[model samples]
Target chain A: MRCWERPLIEIIRLSVNGDSHEIGVPSHYTLLETLRYVLGLTGSKQGCDKGDCGACTVLLDGLPTLSCILPVQEAIGRQVTTIEGLADPDGPHALQDALDLTGGAQCGFCTPGILMSAAALLNVNSSPTRQEIREALSGNLCRCTGYTKIYEAVELAARALREQRPPAEVLRS
Target chain B: MLRLHPYEYHRPRELEAALELLKEHAGDVMPIAGGTDLVPNMKHRLFAPGHLVALKGLPELHGIVERQGEIVLGAAESLSSLADHHLVRSHLPSLARAAGAIAHPMIRNQATLGGNICLDTRCTYYNQTFFWREALGFCLKKDGDVCHVVRGGTRCVAAHSADTPPILMALGAKVDTASPEGVRSVELDEFFIADGIWNTQRKPDEIVTRLRVPLPSPGLRTSYQKLRERRSVDFPLLSLALAVGLDGDDRVESIALVVAALGAKPRRIGGLETLAKGERLHDELIEEIARQAYRQSNPLDNIIVDIEWRRAMVPVFVRRAIREALARP
Candidate 1:
């Protein structure tokens, strides 16, 4: 019998960000493999094979789960995320635009995880503090991006979100 | 890292069927609740059960209830859920605090309270993958004979390094377990076996169902303290959970001090209670009790972080946990 022929490969149907990834992942394969190999959604980088590195960060059921360590079988029916899910490529988020304009993408290997972390924060609180940004981005490491510009980018995003706030009186009245 | 040898997965919706699977497969079958702990271990090939019994489908294993006066927490309740439970916060506040302190928010969302309680026994020597263990000719906990922790110790010296046990014990909780034989209640304190090779005396067939903590009476106060190398995701080098009460005059009524991540079980320090009862807590008295605790703790080279630092922090955390519990004006 072949390695995957033992009635193996549990059919995993996942809703990744807004897209769907229905793949025949092997029993031993990780969710990272599903993203990188199967569907070619390679935004979730595989930095640390173990759970230590946050590079494989993805939103499983809207929480930042390290996909490299998380089993692919575990993602069945759960929502997954990647940098690809942050925004439409043409319509970049203030966070993404800020990162790009502020040169937060030096080497870019770790930018995806950093963006995912920041995007999760901006999803909840549009206007976050400087300390809050630091706390939120603590898990994602960027060796090339020395975090000064990244911090500035978070500040810029917070400002943009606050300035772009909807008129409360218009909605209410 | 080693690979997880593939095992057939079975998801049974009911508890009885899961137990039946356990009976059929015996040692070869492993039941997974949260998969926060087991899946990582499987990938490491630390203990590869031949059959993987997925317990996520069993609804009976999950839920939180306030029955009568006691808080009944199902085994599948996640750490994040426990941290967020209003009843748990009001009744067993230290448990909530401990649950929140574990790992990080992401891990807490997936790592259940029962998973933390039933976390596989750990040690620096024993936690490595199968191949690493094989290189060392195995240790006492798994496939080998001698304990590397104690050099020639006859038993496995793997520590019961769970953060939740000490807090649960301090809260006066009891657990209900179901088996093919019948159901039985084990006091949270008595549930942990002192032996490491066979860490828990619980029968393999018995599955922990619900943990119940009695309602908090008036004058109850609680606090939890953890000492680790860094703040996030690292297991405690030394942890203490303190829960106590004061009479009308603010005299000590009842006291519990439990230490975790130090030994094979969450060892209750009966000596600390001697200093607590009948006296009004003062800084001098607190310091005296902590000193006694520090001397009593015997840490080995079996865990990460300095054993000396772990031993040193015992009194500090004990003092903090107690002080926080009593926090007088």
Candidate 2:
């Protein structure tokens, strides 16, 4: 270990979901804690608190990352997109609607993180194969659905995004 | 919810400042690149550093550049980026594969190459909650003295579980490190020591800043194969990395077979050079190589699976890795 004397608390600014937030937190607080406890955004779940479970997955600079292990200071100036940021002015994103339609979320504990991961995937590749979707969501675990419905939901959402059709309209068909 | 032990955190924007801080706080501060490994260990009370020097956003330790005939990888480069980098994919696909296969996608996003290379050895006895370890007598790696893995043993036998070191060693990569003293480069093969307690040769104040992989010559082939409990998120029970260079006549010219996760350090088996060099690779020769790897592997009962079974799987994984590397055009 190196020797240094630094203040325990630091004021860090973050750009989260298009909103800039300035918060004073201890350096030890992870981004997950800042988002859930301090900033009052509880969309991301803390399943493992380690990097094992993807329940705390969030998009940092458009890339899905685990916020549990990321220090708040590391995310100071980065763009953080949580599950709460997934919805638009209209309603839930297409992926959320697809999950609702397909009953992809059973316990819903891991839903937010899975949604963030899949959203990041769709944001990059609007139309992805089933295998690609599975690969993209490999980090996210769904113990309840057995991952069948989640895979179907991602496929449905991909089609909805590709066809520029509302998720409700796609589900109706 | 497991909480980290509180400590002063210093985010140094400059590499020089980070090194200086490390030099000043040589015995009290730990450098953190991605907290994927350190934070979890902190939760387990494996370490309680007084201060943490954050290495994030240090321009010196961030980038993958192809210089001259080598791929210069910044130690701070995330595993995700390294896996997706075109240079790594084209020139060192085995490294890319190993990078992608580590932990999971989110972990790969936060974990860096240097962090993985410097990842702490693991044992079931050592990686538990503080209360859990307290209830049971602690092992030699941490608080208690007796080694739980090797009963009555004098030292720690925690297995090295990182997925990159063996592959890097197979590629004959070198790492450049920085300290207040100066910067020095060491071959990856010489970086790791055999002891589980004092795993690497890195000093307290030194920080691994970059890894340089020499560009493969023509006819060079490499592959990395890892066997774990699950495909999603588990450390490798056994991993084999094979790098073979075939002569124009299709005979093995140069070869390196490194088996990891079975011991404290990844070791390159010497039997391959003795048996397969300058010879056309055949099923019998491959079998002999696998047998040698199996004999060299020394798995302990400290990991998830049965020790005997993990030991037996060494040859199987090595055969597969060798076949895969040879099959690639």
Candidate 3:
């Protein structure tokens, strides 16, 4: 048996969605597992636990990262945002409401990851072109193949956010 | 969900400390920059290192600068930043394109240049889950000894599926590394050897610091073309990087074509200067160069793609790459 094969535990600090928490996690745990299992933040879905599917996407220090591949220790001192962080006490995020209203999420298994990816994009480019939206969401895989509606939802959400109106109002417009 | 093997994680604040950790653990510890490659491999049981030394945030390994006629790219710089940087975009657009074309947006945000260049050789047989490989009896790349890609063969033939190394090789780049012993630099051309188990010249204890790409000549035009099933997230089925320097009169002064994703090391097509020098990129000359690329590339069934289909794409992609380069202003 090798020395490194032995399991070890360490206490680490993580900042997620404007909150800070100290938790003990196994040294080998990925951010996705730490979120879903240890911290009970299961909004970051784990799909293709490797780097293939973007279902494990999270916003790390304002950048969308594949949490399944990210070692939890690396998240120290960085802000981690999952799908749960997208909305406040008010309601679902504009993107989420837009996705629901547009019927963009068929299975909902891939929604959390896709929302995180889209949030990262909408944060930077509030008014993204269709091509830019497609490029940004390319990492995420939605098996339902409802990309047309998903793209439409993103377009609709962008207009609502830019106009400072609800996605429902923007959808009607 | 695939689980990572039990291990210890070390995050060193200094490069010296990181090197010391790597030296102390030696073969037991693996340096993890992006974790975009190593993490998945670990989950797949391709690697089970006892310890991982994080190199993502070392100050010494982060930055991009134009230094003395070269573009110095910090090994830890993310692919997203590198692809979007003005210096890389204006000076080495092909490299920028290649960097942008890697994986996808979320991955580019985390993956680094060093990780991409040092990416592991991949194969359908080797990249599978542990049970999948065990049911078939493992191949030469991992626990088993027999070579499944080339049955009865003694060597491992996993494909080098990186998008940027071939471009860096064509651009005459140099790799810089640091260790407890000190720092060392090597030409990117000699950095890779013909072995799929571990292909790079980097020692186990050394950490890649940065890459220095000599600035392109005024008339030099370079382009990269990738053949993947999808536009995002898929590794290259076939990738080609072409660079041609033309005299003021539009006559070829020098040319280089490097094709990858076929073998352990990216194959640089030879005799290109002999055939292309002092000639215009006419239909005949282009066809001849494409033929040279076709003759040199022999893609196997390492990837699930058809071997013959991948081989047929060598010339087609080469011609398209040349046309793309020629079209660039």
Candidate 4:
């Protein structure tokens, strides 16, 4: 295709996790689309498409953001980490493992978003109670199973990290 | 899912530049604050502005400060910042309580106090996505001809949806707006218009720059109470914010009581002052005040939850808000 074939909307190159893209996006394309489509990081699901459903959740500069509605241009100078970035390619995030062990995930459309939200929550609060977990995960929804397992998973992850509290081993090495 | 249609985006550092843009562009431009309300509404296709004048990068519009015995909160200060600011927590505790109760933690981090103050008066018939409205036919607030919420209605019946306005009104806040007409301060009570189509007293070109609040006396007490379906991210079904103080012998010195989600703008049931004069804060007095609140309020069935439940609870919310105000010793 020729350069003139597509509308030349200005874009700031975005680096999500380790990958980078010089994609041409319509001014309205959100960070969620850039991560899921241009970058092929499927871990960031499109749940609500509005900010309400945390299924599109990711960390913008280490704080959880609903990527679905976050303008891509707003991500111009920010760091974005998706759920895929949370774990080593070899395995799942300890939170994810804890989720499985605790049966935290049921219908998994929300799993990726919930995992990222929990990862951010767990990083900030090493000793979150069920109330904190509930509040933190309010943006994300799990309809099939109630919130019991999810709350338990957060507690387990907190304990795991507290005992050893290793710096998250997933992204760099 | 709500999507932002393509629009021109301009970031101007100065307030005058922003107001100039609004003037030149007029109705075509929408001012972007925290996007707490505007962004979501935009996604829902409730609005389709050709330009978005973003205020986030503006240096002049981002602080919470106290000066000359008054607290001036920047129009763009995030709710989280206001909720956490010590001056706000001290002088305007009811306002602080209301701000903290809005939406949720993340929203509070991003929703601006001014953004909530200027929300389009919402009607249940009016707040839905474009597609949802298409299915049901549109109402008076946006695209359609008839007011779905009020049959045979000549004007829109959208409820005042902002959570903070009632609180700010009760705190005796004033808005400072800058337009090509120059700057002016309007008492928060006057800032709202009862007519639903144009709910705000502000001209389209004016930008709310700062809100000023007088310092609270040590004896002044305040409280805020809201009824919403969920603890997070839902607009208020019925809300009340009240501030009260007593004279030398604990009689009602002055009172500021405001209600939201019921009408076009927060209405002051200042009638409570007459009811409270010379009377000690008592269950019977509170009951009268609550009854007066229900009597004064006229809620319509255009939003989520029942209109009857909302009307019935007006007194409850009023009593609770007044009780909270009394509890603020």
Top candidate when judged by lDDT against the true structure? 3
lDDT of 3 by residue, B91-185 (tens): 99999999999999989999999999899999999999999999988999999988888979888899999999999999999999998899999
Q: Which stretches of candidate 1 lie over 4 Å from their true place?
A: A1-7, A102-107, A134-152, A165-173
* lDDT score at residue B27, model 3, on the 0-100 scale: 76
Best by TM-score: 3
Candidate 4, which CAPRI tier?
A: acceptable
Candidate 4 residue-wise lDDT, B1-329, digit = tens: 45577776667878878988988788688788767577768877887777778787677888888899899999899887898899898778777878888776656766787787788777767667788888888877778888877788988778887777887887788999888899999998998988888798888777888899988877677878888888877778989888887777877878777878888888888566677766788888888888888888888887867889988988888777777666656
* lDDT of every model, 2 decimals: 0.77, 0.88, 0.93, 0.78
Clashing pairs in 2: A1-B26, A1-B28, A1-B29, A2-B25, A2-B26, A2-B29, A3-B25, A3-B26
Residue range A37-156, candidate 2, lDDT tens digits? 999999899898977879999999999999998878889778999998999998888999999999999999999999999998998998888888888888888778559899899999
Report the C-alpha displacement of residue B245, candidate 4, in angstroms: 1.0
**Which regions of candidate 2 are displaced past 4 Å?**
A1-7
Candidate 2 structure quality by residue, lDDT tens digits, B44-162:
88988888898867999999999998999999999999999999998999999999999888888889999998999988898898899988888888889988788799877888899
Worst 10 residues of 1 chain B by lDDT: B1-10
Candidate 2 docking quality: incorrect, acceptable, medium or high: medium
Candidate 1: residue pairs that collide: none
Candidate 1 per-residue C-alpha lDDT over B1-329 given as tens digits, one digit per residue, 9 for 90 to 100: 33456667777889999889988888777777767677777766776666777666689988888999888999888887898899888778788888877775566766777777788877887777777888999888778787877877886667777788898898899988887788899899999987776566577667788888888778877889988765766777888888787788888888878887888888887775667789888888788878877777787777867888888889888778877887732
Task: Answer with 2 or 4, whichever has the higher lDDT.
Answer: 2
